[model samples]
Target: MFYWRRVGRIWPVHLVALPLGIYAFYVAAKVDIDWPGLISSVFLVQTWFPDVTPTLPGNPVTWTLSVELLFYALFPLVAPFADRMRTRWLMVATAVGLFGMYLVNWVADATLDPTMARWVMRHPLVYLPEFLLGMTMALALRRGWRLPLHPVVPLAGLFGWTYLYYQERWPFSDVVEHQMEFAMRPMVGVLSALIILAFLQREARGHRGILNNRLLVSLGLWSYSFYLVHHAISRLATYEFGRMPDNNAVLFTLIGMAVVINVICWALFTYVEEPAEKWWRKHTPKRWLDRGGETGGSALPPAPRREAETAPAPV
Candidate 1:
């Protein structure tokens, strides 16, 4: 049931994006794409293979989705155990997850070619610890664990790290292109978990903030569709517009193209992704397993599923 719901929610936009992605490849270069790699992408299994094959033949961004599908497949197995962990164990789990992340990065660095090493580094298993961190945080939040620090601290730290990386101020930036980035995932996960907990705390208390702003929330609603098509849109924009001569011109072009892409993304979400989910939810009956009996009925009102359950599942 969960798997099918995920299919319903994402596959429509994904299917459309795949063809558009092919067009993006074609536009970028007539002979650059590998048909087999594109097929692997269509199945969302490209990341399981080496990066020697075209990693993002269809949709470059969807490589993350391939990793995400792995998480989705594994969640059912992990959730039961994770939910039963006590708050103290949640802290232990976070530490273990971060340790696992470091191990994966070490393994990927030591083993695999540079190209394939990067691929392995981004593989679902390598990043599964981030997912575990998120799950642990959510379970902790449900158990009423309060935030240990101000929300702004983590938020600032998170963005500050990103900004430093962007500005090439990171200490290891010169030594390696991606290993440093991969090494930072545990830190990013920690900050992100704190931010999530803080905002959830705010929501629980009925406090209004930018997280709940109408426009921002609406953008969040279309985020999946935006993710699906943004790469293709950006590629097409670059192909059509070429490079701008100045920084200001580049900024203006990017802003304009972003607005256009968002408008199109809004349409796709309204007309395709949302409708597909609704249709699937309406047509697919509640499973007997979910209902806890063969009769497919329950006395209690259906509980709200977690956002993680329906999230984009991106790494």
Candidate 2:
């Protein structure tokens, strides 16, 4: 039950967070939320609609969930085809998919106003290539292909690209600058995949790194909850306190908020995400999950669980 597993992984936290975030917005921002948008948002289809009010409703950050939902719906169809392709060919297809995003972005930027262009670029369909890129890397790794990459190279590239692109520091013609702007999504996707591949290779080879420790690993586990709730908290804080003066004193406020966010995320993960996922798996319908004339639910044979690398990639 791939669909079931994905639903179980994603929905439990969303269900809890959605209303809570809506309430936070109501109290803090007094946002003129488009109510009908909530329905699409709950279904994780809000990003597919150009008319979505305020772009996202409820938890504004849940647009990523919309993207994930699209990926889940398409993964089975894509996976069978992807699994059959040789690693080289699979990468070729991924590259093409990513290139398609640049064209889509270019066309949207050329044809639409800035806001509509932004929305078009953000559409879930436009992001499927990033998902494919991750999958391609996973398959290539499994196929015993290795790249001579250190994580730092791509990590640095990511930071450098973000700075230069956002600040428009490079001397380029207007058309070239526009190309770089549109090219960001795909470029970042490739860089991100490379960073992940470097670490994946290291972990596969039984090496340990700073992130392999339990504290950070647990933080990583809590990150989804952190992502879900952090914005609401920030919204509430900003509304209550107003903007802090742009001085080092703001670091104290940031540190305090970070602590509070982690504490809340820890509670959310413990009470919601972990328990819900376990229960979801425990209760999945046999007919949906079992096809081999075998026992159902959590009865599948156990394997070494490197939870560090998985929370099932729904991210």
Candidate 3:
């Protein structure tokens, strides 16, 4: 997806996630003593559970990271399928089919074997539809499919989702658990699509948007670095200060800690993630065909172009 390419630039989203991580750690520390489990989960490094606290209060949303990574891996392939579905009806049908499968799985979970049910829930295959939905939205925008772009839609969607998220009630929980698993898909997708379209429209009409502001673009550039390191920093702060009473003093301390952690994360992002990504792209081998050679197992396209070139050509 074209947006996936821009995702590498998503520092702002981490700003949101970082605070939530701190809040999650604070809540988890308050809930119960599972020192051994928590420590083991943190150190395991191989599983998603450790990287993001899944069951913590105030942060049930972190499970999506596993799905996000899965999307990152598969997006290049899925983008093409999205590009091929020509009409809005087709896109809507595909999305409905995906949600229908989820509904079926929700029903099946009742009678399925315990191990199989868990596998089905956690498996990357389950999220392909969500990722494809996002890819489809991107494709739709690229093909000039018009959608309403009023700011209120995204603002309302965000507020509605947040309200539903915090209410922690029945239908909301069910919606969050299943039907809304991909809730952010539509909200973020619509907001971003509108913003991009508006920017294009403004440029064509000889008007510039605040998005052209240098500060916003710079922050956007640093956003990925912020994302990679923010959770770890939040966890570190939680471990150090989480045992304190939840008073204003404690809250301020935690906030201070979070700020420091974010600053450090920003530094690491600038010095580490950005440079590493660039180095990898520069040093990685290009396809043999592109290099005018005809030898080797399979000459994959260079890592950067791999996603775009592999994406299904638009029909």
The candidate scoring highest on lDDT is 2
For each candidate, give its TM-score against the true structure. Answer: 0.85, 0.88, 0.58
lDDT of 1 by residue, 1-315 (tens): 666667787687898778787888665656466778888888888888875356555788888898889888887677777765565676787789788887777677778677777777777888787777877776656655565465788899888978876776555644465655656878777878888877877776687878878999999998998898888878777788775676666787778888998998899898988888788766666563465443324222333445444232221
Clashes per candidate, residues 3 or more apart or on different chains: 0, 0, 2
**Which tens-of-lDDT digit does each residue in 68-165 have in candidate 3?**
66676665565455455555655776568576556646654666775555545555556566565656655554544445354455556666766665
lDDT of each: 0.74, 0.82, 0.51
Output the TM-score of candidate 3.
Answer: 0.58
Q: Global lDDT for candidate 1?
A: 0.74
Evaluate model 3: give its lDDT: 0.51
- What does each candidate score in C-alpha RMSD? 6.1, 5.9, 9.0
Better by lDDT, candidate 3 or 1: 1
Candidate 2 accuracy as TM-score: 0.88
Report residue 148 deviation for candidate 1 (angstroms): 3.6
Segments of candidate 2 deviating more than 4 angstroms? 167-177, 292-315
Which pairs clash (backbone N, Cα, C closer than 3 Å) in model 3?
Answer: 11-223, 80-312
